[model samples]
Target chain A: MGPDGSRPEPPDNPPSSEDTQRNAGARGRPGAGHILPVNRADIPFLAALGVVASVYIVLIAGIVLAKVFYVQLPLVGEVFTNPGYRYAVVLSLVSCSITTILSVWIAVPTAYLMTRVEFPGKRIVDAMLDIPIVLPPLVIGLGLLMLFQTPPGAFVQQYVTFTYAIPGVILAQFMVACAFAVRTMMAAFAEINPRQEQVAVTLGCTRAQAFWMVVLPEARRGMIPAATIAWARAMGEFGPVLVFAGTTRMRTEVMPTTIFLELQVGNLGMAAAVAAVMLALSLIVLILMRLAGHGRMF
Target chain B: MIHFDNITIRLDGFALENINLHIPTGAYAVLMGRTGCGKTTILEAACGLRPIESGRIHLMGRDVTDMPPGRRNVGLVPQDGALFTTMTVEQQLGFALRVRHRPKGEIAARARELAEWLGIGHLLHRRPHGLSGGERQRVAIGRALAAHPDILCLDEPLSALDEETHGGMLDLLRHVHEDTGVTVLHITHNRREARALAQSLIIMRGGRFLEGETARGQLAREEDDA
Candidate 1:
């Protein structure tokens, strides 16, 4: 509606709905395809999902930010200065980084196999890769613990010593984080037209050469976000870390476990301060995702 | 030179069956067919991109039926150019040589020479999206020719061009054929393109060849149906 309160005319050369269909945000839309005046009444029913999602996002973000702001800086400092906190920070950075790298290494081959091959049990394998996402993290912890009771698992425990140790946190984080990475990479690989690689093969390159030169470079956009999200997911994982690694102070105590331990001892301010730190890191990741996600160049 | 003897390709429910063809070395042969008549399928099969159900494919007197696309020494310029968006035209042209680990000076010289021959020398630094339809097609042809393949396969490379550019592309193809004497198999449904570019013609219908003296009329009917 116009300011004069007269019935507003339709926009001149109102753009087709096609260009804006895929993109959720308004700003990233192409220039010529936008500038059409939108009618409030004309919003589609499907937009209700977007509206609901946005509201949920805003409410959660708003509350988290408010709580983060309400924490006293000295209290945050106190929590931050604890020897246990310093160890947690260092352990987390090391374990999460290792988990993220290992997950990506596993994801590349797994995603490629899912995309390119047509084996007898390919669908079954694909579905099984997604099991971690559907299962509770606690179940994963229990499963890992049970597996370590078997001969090969006992061997792994004895030799590599992953159970109830620093390496256990890495293994737990890797198990969960790798699943997300595989899913992310599969979606990324699916979006790429295999024709480019086929063309590269026609142009005197072997299949492996074609994948390295053409497919990998083209997939960088997708790979960045996949790695980032998996990193963030690994960093924030709590249940599995707590169950498998036992939350030992200065040992397997990651940031999430630190928050848990602080709360268990009834240090509300320290718990909130740790929670706020996690929240801030997550918010930074989300912002980075929005800036470079969905194939937008960083 | 390419020889296909009783080749069968099954894609989904549709089957391209019992195809027999022999293209002599250095001949510019055009294969004409309606949409869904399995033109691209035959091309892909020849390139070893599609696995054939039966029979053998021989290129340059060597059996390539069980070989991969890279070792076949046959290059393709697909419909819509299929230009690599990640690379400039120069990079696209030199990609084959680069894959072979050729020295930079050698690759650059070959790329520049091929670009000039294909009339896209000026577009060397430009990305695929920055070029026009004809220019991209020209670069696509140049890229295919970069490795000096024994045979070149073009899938409707000029189908999207305007009438003026259509003639120009035909002339360019003719010039390339004359200059390089590379065996060329061109796919098109347009009779004008067949008339202009085809030194030898094969018409395909449903999966089989429309052979003998009546092949031209059958090709015309297929074009009309298209």
Candidate 2:
């Protein structure tokens, strides 16, 4: 319509009434593509579902927090301050750190190879790596005990014992944690586009240079979360450490095994205290990851 | 200069048969074809991305047919821009310089100069995901040029850009041709694009070039059908 108070001429190809209504926002511009109109009735259904889910989640979380923060539990403070508990905590931290570092060092390269290369028996090797995840931890403990207990064990034990000791705990944790780490890293590697590496190659990067400069940077997003999960898994590992490396105070005992040993002796307060520490550590990891914008890194 | 002496390559369901191509020093040659017509396959073969079944590829008088991509001294700007998403645009441009151990001050200056030349001077600190499609393409071109490769292969450089940016990209391609005297092998499916930027044209179909001077005429027909 002109501003001179004259009626506008009809368009050369006049749009139908329905078409005009549908294109109200798209006039004189490129179409934003044909989108299905939102169904108005589904709004109420979606609102109701969101309300119910929120309430359910809040209720579950409240219950768990109430159990975890049992303020009235007697002797809890003493259990934490106890020298024995302090030793157990330090040992757990050290053992978990070692396990995590070793697993990451070995698994990252294996994951990269598994994702980026073609070789014989790759499928079988990949499937074999997952065996530790599915097999019960206690069974894995027993297997490790056997593997290191017989002729090979005897040969190695002459230099260093792998059964019923610190080495046994480490081996068990390594076996399980490395498998989990590799699985996590393999999935991460799979998500990265291979085109990035190819581009680097064309830009004069050698294979190793491309990996360090391009692929590894892109992988940091997923790798951070994978490492957090693996560290947590290693920290909380109990069955393997218990059976293979008998729960000995100030030696092979980790947090979970210590909790179990406390429970066997009817020390509920001490057991709960240890559980609370593990829970606190897990919460710390979660909070740090959230602060780092874990999900948005990609 | 880049030379392809009757090279052939076979993939899963397609084959490039006894193809011959030569891009003279400082020439801009475009390969035009429809979808699945092996235009990109030819570029990849030239870059040594795919193994050749026969014949040889020579870049700057050196036979690179059996060489790895890293050793071929060739650069590629793929359809997706293929920027390292985690690296800043400046680092992306400086990557080749760093690999070749160029002086730090020279690398930074050259990267900035190229980025400015491509009209992406302000985006040097940003990552690929932070840039628009046109910006990413410019950065990709800058990255390739920074490598100082003797030959560059661009696979469908403008196929993904919006129409509004298409003209500007052609201008940039022309500028790149003028600046470096870099031999370029550009692949496209658009006749108008080939006409605009290509100093020479090669038409391919069904993994083989249709023989004779009828190549351009056949492309016109394909465009009409399209």
Q: List the global CA lDDT of all models.
A: 0.80, 0.78
DockQ-derived CAPRI band for the predicted complex in model 1: acceptable
Off by over 4 Å in 2: A1-40, A43-63, A69-74, A292-298
lDDT of 2 at B35: 88
Native contacts kept (model 1): 0.41
Model 2 chain A lDDT-worst window of ten: A1-10
| lDDT (Cα, tens digit) per residue for candidate 1, span B5-87 | 99988988899778899989999989988898889999999888999999999999999999889999988998877777678
Model 1 chain B worst lDDT run, 10 consecutive residues: B205-214
**lDDT string, candidate 2, A1-298, tens digits:** 1111112223442432223322432222344335455589888988889899899889989856865776335555655577777777877878887888888888889999999998999999989998999999999998888888688778998999878888888888888998988987887777676877888887777789999988887676556656776788888898888889988887888889888998899977777777777777777766675456344221
Clashing pairs in 1: none
Model 2 reproduces a share of the real contacts of 0.46
**Any idea what lDDT model 1 has?**
0.80
Q: What's the lDDT of the predicted structure labeled candidate 2?
A: 0.78
Give candidate 1 misplaced runs (Cα > 4 Å).
A1-54, A284-298, B160-164, B222-226
